[model samples]
Target: MIRSGQRSWLGWLLSLGLVWFGSVTEATAQAVPQPHVKAELIAETTAIRPGTPVWVAIRLELEEHWHTYWRNPGDSGQPTSVKWTLPPGFTADDIQWPIPKRIEVSGLVGYGYETEALHLVRITPPADLPVGKPVTLAGKVKWLVCKEECIPGEAELKLVLPVTGDVPPPSTWTEAFSRARAQLPLATSEWKLGATVEGDAVVLLLSPPTPTEELTEASFFPFEELVIEGAEPQKLTRVKGGYVLRMTRSKVAENPPTRLAGVVVTPQGWRGAGTEPGLTVDVPVEPPTAFGDALTPTAGTTASKPSGGQPLGWMGLWLTLGGAFLGGLILNLMPCVLPVLSIKVLGFVEQSRAGRGQAWQHGLVFTAGVVLSFWALAGVLLALRAGGQQLGWGFQLQEPAFVAFLVAVLFVFGLVLFGVFEVGVGLTTVGGTAMNRAGLAGSFFTGVLATVVATPCTAPFMGSALGVALAQPTAIALLIFTALAIGMAAPYLVLAAAPQLLRFVPKPGPWMESFKQFMGFLLMGSVVWLLWVLGLEVGVDGLALMLGVIVLIGLGGWIWGRWGSYTYPALTRRIALATAGIIIVGSSVWGVSAIHQLPPVASAAATQPEAKSGSIRWEPFSPARVTELRRAGKPVFVDFTAAWCLSCKANERVALETAEVRAEIERRGIVMVKADWTNRDENITRALADFGRSGVPLYVFYPPNGNEPKVLPEVLTPGIVLEAFRETS
Candidate 1:
């Protein structure tokens, strides 16, 4: 284990602060707080002839287990990123990613590898090459690396190469460099890469198949970001010797570039990397008609704007409101909302019995709170956007502080549900039994609380609505916001307006206590989820502190609960309150200080490969290796999943455990590897991201070379699980 030594007292103080302030919110937050990546430029060719391409690469080596992300970092984690500064005449081509193995950890999936992976770039020598001089290439590299907690790392890397004739690179460093170059993805063998000028957009075509052409599983990774949404790639169908990949180009470009870069992975475990050759109408190249009918540019012209703008209209307003409203309503059901909702619900039930008039009044106040909170959120988002920030809705949760606050709120609410605390008389008036449980204030607050939780989930109607609303004028934006408030508050308002609805609810009795307790259990589960999220954000140490905080709270509660037994009730109450308050404050302070006491932020490194490290041996996923083992006749089970997706968790719980699946693996000496994709891991992300996916649920089985590896469906069944393993065996 690497131990952090205390050097500067100030640094140590900051480390403590990190520990204390780090919360569950920080745990699963996607972006790293401080990027820690370092980059250097290495070139084999000092100078090259004009019109000829030379090999130049920006080699980034992450510290230890911390890994930079790939262009497509599976479902989670930021991709390792770079922006190159080149001279006017010179331009750099896309960096090529080596084939990556899938890594699975906990229940989440990620795409990255331990140790090192290099990104190679092909540079086109300037046509007007200046002799005897070198040009400088500079780049700013920023990346997020995560082992458990993620930190952002960045560096400025520069390199200068001398100009020379078209002689082959020197043999001294040539072999090593050539080997690295060969490791890059190869273009399709059977498929000739080329672009066709369709009516409006240019369609790139892939021709020629590998030696083995029966493609049961295959996908492509576009060279450019934003060109592809990283959605699942369309299926590959065999046509004679080659297979055609049906994919849509990005909405940015009108005509295809001179070259398109991509990676193609087949069942053979073969990765092909090459540029899609351009189609010259003069060469009699056949235009592809099968790839989904050529996309028609919106304006009937091929020119695509860098920033795609939406068509103006009221539809945008409607979309925003509809999304917000639906999102708000759905928030009532999120785990994070349950504890707060329970408190509001119970208070309402009590208030209803007291009087209908008071209940209605309470409801309106709560509604105001909910609407105001949403508007506040909208204002913040708008402000950020106006300031040129790149963010989307739900960005607040990306902060560890926000997550910590939510976690605390939920924990306290959970305690309240368990009867550890209660709102005093002033606050109680709104929801007490004397007022009747559905007090207007309590109900309204519930609506507001629901909206807060609703921020996380984008409901069915929310996407298009929010998308449209976000693109609208400021006046229109507020109008949509109002519509959303109306939608979200409608259900609560209806219940408040119709006291008859109260009559429909069965009279509360002993079941009330049991229900409250059940909700408490649900709240506890939410805490567990939050803890996991926290683990992802700040590492395990922060989680330990959180656990400590919970324990401290529990102790304080215990003290408070028993304090009323003293003869002097007033004095006892005062002492108990003081003691509890002190404990809460002390714990919070200590926790915050402790967290911040660690080291200066460093990016998280990818865990070392199990096989090489000898920690826990997991064979890398390779077609040759799988074939060799199978011919020796062993079962091979490849888990192609990542760490950020939730569906991957459920499948692991329900499907991986069935007796049959375990028996096959153990009995047949099956090779199993769990690809983890939680943080920004380049290798694994490139692997999965290359396949046109951002999340997990991928499983593959390789029997022998004769029989191609079977691609399992996203959702797993007991039979599906058993059958795949059996085939491999």
Candidate 2:
């Protein structure tokens, strides 16, 4: 209730009569002049209810692209703060802060806001205060707003509210207050969190109630200073069934704190979807321990070896092996491997007509080629990483020279397929040395080609294996790679060992020439894709030079086809071959040298905000829009289903289509949406991950009051949905 000392209706009438005199009652609470900003003090309540608390906020509306700081200003700025000058007998609590964005400018990293911000504080009044009179809440706010230049601004703001004995109406800022509250970090008990000091780094341990995604990025903004180097990246990785984020310690920290206090912000909310992205962290900091114990599996997850010196254990080893094998098998179907498919098929067909012994030999040679290629590639990658190159798989592809090389190789192969020219050996073993098409040498080279193309794709199930493999010693890493090679070559090995399977291949005839020519066109398609990749790597000028080099190669191929045949006289044929070699070599050398020197287009490209880095998905609802509404504390309902499923249609017609359920949804202020999964959608699959559901008919409800979102039963009825809607109230 409000202060009870008011003199009935007579005093209220007299105060209304003198409203124009000196009373400060007004619709808005604007501020003293501040350049580039509009500042004010506003209350969430229409009038102060004495003996109860009221939310008063310091509202700073900044100019476009300008920003103000958070509690910890990070590297080189001051945080926004306020000093209260309130009436006696009135008490004010400290400001309640919303999570801040990471701001980087001129190599300095800071935590702040970009636009309008509200610093909310709770004000509790005395019970004995007289009613029907206005109370002035004054605050002096000082802030540093920055773009390229930093400007400090100060303003004295006031909000006038009359003390009333009745329940007060919510002011216009009620919605804003709710939004600010939603932005505040949520304290959760779903994860058992702790911190450990690992040498110069701080390792945060989070044990979730269940397994979480393998996240690549996360931001931890510590409340305490000298805890972490804010500008450095916080590398997050999955361990067993939980997660760990290792961060660099600040140079100023002479000793570790008793506890690490901060907010862990992730767009795929720490407590999962439809919840606040900012999570409150206040866990004790302990001394370091080996991953074996610290990262022991809570359920099915365990701590990783982390480095090569330790063992990945039998369980980890098996998981890695299985994952690598599956990934390698999947690689054959990736775009990179498609160009060589037809050639391999033709070789297999040719082998079907050959002796079984020859086919077996060719298979063995091909397997050797693939295995050795992987060995060489993996060794180089491991060595570079050991030497601190900070590289990952496919690191070579980032080089323009490498891209150009791939383009040229694919183009030449395309020419071979199109009968532009012929090599003594093909990439696959076929009719042997007699046919001048493919030989044992060809089989080995084809395996090498397969390995090279397969590097570009990181297929499903490969992540856990490859990620762990690279962290191991050279020997262990190679073992994993060997498994991958064997998996990739498994199908070919099976065919080679059992020539009976090749009986399906037709005998060589007119169709053979047509088929070879068709395969050549397929290779050309691969060349086109490589050209596109080259254009991206090198700008337009570089692309033009590379195309010129390709044209020269094509000409050289034509020259060789014209005169290198035995039908030509010896001296003329020899000269033609030498000229073709010289042109091909010279043009390739010139083109690659020119392209590698060009600056990457990405350097000038605009940067996306760090928040959008994660692979967060929402099917029917836009991820950004849902995040926006969630941040504003709005209620939302999503039905993840497929039209092909009869149950979804039945539920829609019987429950959702009914006026009663529809009215309840609208009454709850819920934004209802549906995602059709009739056809496979990767986005829908990812959204389903939000609820830990793999398939459709999933229902989720986000309440307006900021409670953890609820996942309803897969089978929904009007009663269940109506009950879910009641949560919004």
Candidate 3:
């Protein structure tokens, strides 16, 4: 209805109105507000050079009282993440997070960035990129922001920069990028970090390259989940090199971590102003040795030995010495030593018929042998300890080779007792012999053998006395060992001194031969026990080797006994004996080498807490496991035992394996941990030292509330174990 010129004007106006409407809609969509955070993509430079790297940041600004999580979130919450979309020649590296603060919400703790944060990323452009072109770096950023409640938000952010051959000028975001870079964790090499699991805490040792200022506050943000209790306070102790931070282990940390990777925050005074915020470290966790300050002996004390309890006064020292003597006297009655002592007793009976002087002289020489052996053992123990070796009583038996040697010795002694060969023929008195001189030498050798066999038994009262001796000065320790030796020889010495006591002894006759044969069986029993111990140490293949060696030894013994005693051509006899010796020596060496080559026996079955076939189950002991369980608020019962320890075996068979004890343990949910000292386990040795005792049969009970563990007696009864549970529960 309008004119042509008017119609053209109307069409132009209509088109203009439509374009304005479209612009408004696009602006509204782009300006939409996130739930609790605002995010933007920023660049440090307006342009990027070809073949050069440039920094880009995802800036997250949270609302008042709101926060974004750090990489480790801590206990709960999700950290900020970004997915990049870059040009073909451009590559984006991982996000670099700034130092975060610890935030507590209710009872939970979290690590996060409050107020604002810039996560920096490095973008590298290919050298072949055309300098005239522009490139767009885009990111889809997502974050969890929290106040009283958490809200998730996402943003699509992009930055366009022109590629140039020259260095770009700084943009408006330069200051922000600099600030973010300042807050980032320093390189790991700047500081030395070490971690150890001690009791219920993870001790972190931090040593800075330069002397650091006195630290007033510090915190750790673990990169791994469930390693430490985020809510628990960390204990910091100033040490020689730097500081040791003791953080409580989380209940969920079942195994000790191989490395502690995380960020640590300290005050401005700690490492100077520039490095005030944080340090990123990945430290290898090492087993604690006696070298650290924590293990160093107290002022005025020698070596690293801890005071087992209160210092022993003169009266207490004498009492401990008396206890040592009584323990040694009881050692004579222990099954491990009794068989050999019975042989010595027979020797005494034979000497008694001769005269008092002869018997007394033999007893003195035997006593001298025992005393000298004890001195040697004490010296070795002290020397090794001084040299930083964790050794205890009966430690020699832990070696497979030593155990094999003992087995061979016992087998040969058994053959002698069975009268396969006379005592002086090819054994103890091979070279020369006045009959009396041969007898004296035999007595001395018997004492030495008895001392060697007695090592595996921990008689009553021996634990406490030996513990005190090892913890004391070298001189005092030797004195205690000497007292033990004297007590062992006391009964025999007394009988020899007073010949009147011989009247009660049965006279030697045909019964003597039968008795000697019976003693041989007992010696064979000991050999069987040693073989069983070896089996536990080295697994099935090692057991086969030992059995084969036993067969070879028996064949050599028979050949030597049959031929060596009778008259024969000298050359033929020498050749025959040499052949026998070669067989025995070769077999023994091969067996020992094979045993060493075998892998360590797995104790998986022994490490569970459930009963199997009506027997109590136990988990193999580990120091870290004990600490982890204790921190989890569980009760723990540790049995420190060795296969060679007769007391340990007896207790296992009598009390621990009983149905009543097993049921009680299950009911109480006790964590039964067995520390097998059958091999050279430094962990077990350290644990023994912690208890002020140096030997096995140590029973330590940790209550549910994490109190100091209660030590049960070396010998346990079902009632005693149950009663202990009741008290702890």
Candidate 4:
């Protein structure tokens, strides 16, 4: 958001040095300050031991809300660095950092400290006899702290301590060092970690030696840039025996790194009692598999010949058809589909007085609409996958533009439900297209809307069925999609075919109007959720513009209802109609322009709420760690999930998040790792293929004594989970 004119001089000044040696004005034996922060040099020991390393530090205490950066400043900004000016035979080690926090501003993420940050360094002295002699450790410290604007700061500091043969009492800052040490990440062989390339993602695999305390915060700060996309989402997914954090690959990074290093920080204690908050990560990265080779079936995979060109046995095809059908049947109940379907069905209720033939007509048209829409989406999926895009089910909603369009669509519908405007001969559809026909147009559009919104969820049978469908020939995939469509549309078809069901429906009267308005409020609630999702994808600016578009849509609806409704003169109605069109279309164009095609800027992942009391804390999945744990006689459970997957979220709430489940897992000493696939993840996609699934919620459990990993059911319950563990035992 910084304009070209703003902070041009700051960039020039940054060129001066990483350790910007500002002219000194010492307060107490050498400490300096300016605008927003105070910088100083401090020591850990009152007296230094000769022939050994002594601890010294550069401390910066900033004014409230202004802050500096970590070694890796993330998407934007420079790190606080120091230039040592020590006497001969003196050596300074690299700064030993305490864990830095995740800082977010204007949709950018950075790893840094707030309120205060103390960076420690070791100053080593050569072996020599110099008793009772004072030595000064001179250094220049430079940093950049930012709020609305960034300010460059520095100070030359000299810490004088007496050299002695005997150990000296701890300095005044002993307690401070102790506190910061608790936050520092230490190397641990207890964890077995590695990394792999999954198309545009770099997944860091982390495995703990044993079950860990609940990890309320799991943010990874890469030691170096170009190894991973720092600004994009680092999805933490659970897998059998370990955890995987899927990071978007940096666009500028063309080659895979031999070693990707960083720190994984947990504020509320990632590990169990009496453990450090920060854990070091230095792992080797795996190269990517060739594209267009997905689901080719590896040695360990169950499905050997699953591709679009090859035909499955008739039995397998039938099973796939059945599964697809059932998946669609369940899809109607998903969170995304209900709002649209609810209003559509209410329209059917209003048609109770209409003849059964008319009702039957509406039903058939609605079913046709659903079936055709499915076919279209299936075609797009097939063509794209054929063209070598690693997309899976529910891919349509992944686009921020599509989600924004849905928000606009739903907002206008809510307005209509509130009687803002009704689509008649005078005005157009909420999408801004004229609807010349009657009830049939409403029915068909309802079916289409249902299909569009249903793309963000994956039902039980849908994942595997979709896997098989996409791997089959184009015709076969279309047929499978048809089955799914019919399944979803079955209930409406049945109701329309049997007018007797209408008898159960309430009589349409004043109450129906109130109910319709109430459904409007519910649709508005859905709009709120969609808006939040959009904001995460496009940032606050994009979100604000989208809100403005929604406002325009509301205005258009009012204008149409006020002046273009049946009560207005023809010429007046025409002018209002044209004016509404301009407002809606213009605002929509303006809003969409705000969508940034570039990857997310320097913004950390939003702070997730701490796990509820008695909940299990899961770790990052590391295959090597899982193997080690198994060898040592331990069990691991992993859940492959995504942010957009409603079924995944539902499972977490219903089966996994309960206190009983946590207790049982704890009793069994099971380690849990989550492999999140909310975004496009090639590794997760391939992992799904290894299990013959194309989507989540996949569950795999690794029990002790080298038992084979047990793949649990897509849907879960406490008894079911307990029984799985028992069987493995």
lDDT of 4 at 575: 97
Give the runs in model 3 whose Cα sits over 4 Å from its true position. 1-313, 338-342, 423-435, 567-576, 593-599, 603-611
Q: Which predicted model would earn the best TM-score?
A: 3
Q: Where does candidate 3 have its weakest 10-residue lDDT segment? A: 295-304
Candidate 1 per-residue lDDT, tens place, 1-729, comes to: 434564566566654443333222122222222444455566554345566776766555556766656666654567766798876677788777665433333433445545555677777767788754556666776766777777776766666555544452332234646656655555434445554443433344444445442223444544445443343234333332234444455455554444545555442433332332211111122355533322211100111111112233344344556666775565454333543555566655654454466556655766776678778777787676545444444555444445445566567556656767554333323223454443344455555556665554333354334544554556666666666666666666666666566775557677766676666767676667766655665678777777898788777766766673345479888898789777766776666566545332212222444433212244554334443565565556666543223345556657875567666666666676555444333334333422322234456665534355565765577788887766544
lDDT of 2 by residue, 1-729 (tens): 535455556657654544432234646465655888889888886787678888888888988988999898888788888888888899989888899987777767788888888888998999887877788888888999899999999988888888777667677778999999989888875777888887788888877776533332357888877788876656554454366777888889778777899988765566665568788899888766634455421111112334212335566688888878887777676555776787788778877877778778878888898999889888887787555344455555556787788778777777777776666655434333442325878888889887886654455565456666775667788889888888788888889889899888887777877887888888787777666666655567777888899999999889988888889899998998999888877888878888878876531111221212221122344444555566577777777654323345556667776778866765666776565443334444444533333334566777777665677764568898888788545
Candidate 3 lDDT tens digits, 1-729: 899999999867754544443233223323225887778877787677899999988888778899989899998899999999988977989999887887877768888888887899998999998974667778888889999899888988877666666666666668999889888888754567888887778878876677633443467888888888987767554445565677888888788777888987774423565554778768787777722644221111111222111235577689989999988888777666754755675665576476778778878877887888888877988899766677898877877777788787778778777866544622332222232776777777777777777866677788778877886778888989998888888887887688778887686577867776787787788888889888887876777788888899878777767676658677766776777778777787777777767776754335444546767667777766776677678888888888888888878888888889989888989988888888777767766765556887888888897555678887788888888888877
TM-score of each: 0.44, 0.47, 0.57, 0.55
Model 4: per-residue Cα lDDT over 1-729, one tens digit each: 777766786555543321121111112345577678887888776666778888877888889999899999987888999999987788999998888876667767777889888998988887883765667788888889998689888888887666666665466677888887888897874666777776777766666667542221256788897777655645544454355566777888777667778987654354554678678988776653422222121211233223112355577799989999899888877665765755665655654645677668878888998999888888887898665566677677666777777887788778877888776521112222222356577778778888877755767787778877776778888988898999989988888888777787676567866777787888898788788767766678777878888988889888988898768889999999899878877777666655635243211112332344677676644344544566567787878776556667778888988878888898898887766565455555656655666667788877775656788877788787888888997
How far is 30's C-alpha from truth in model 2 (Å)?
87
Candidate 2, superposed: residue stretches over 4 Å from native: 1-309, 426-438, 603-729
Worst 10 residues of 1 by lDDT: 297-306
What's the lDDT of the predicted structure labeled candidate 4?
A: 0.70
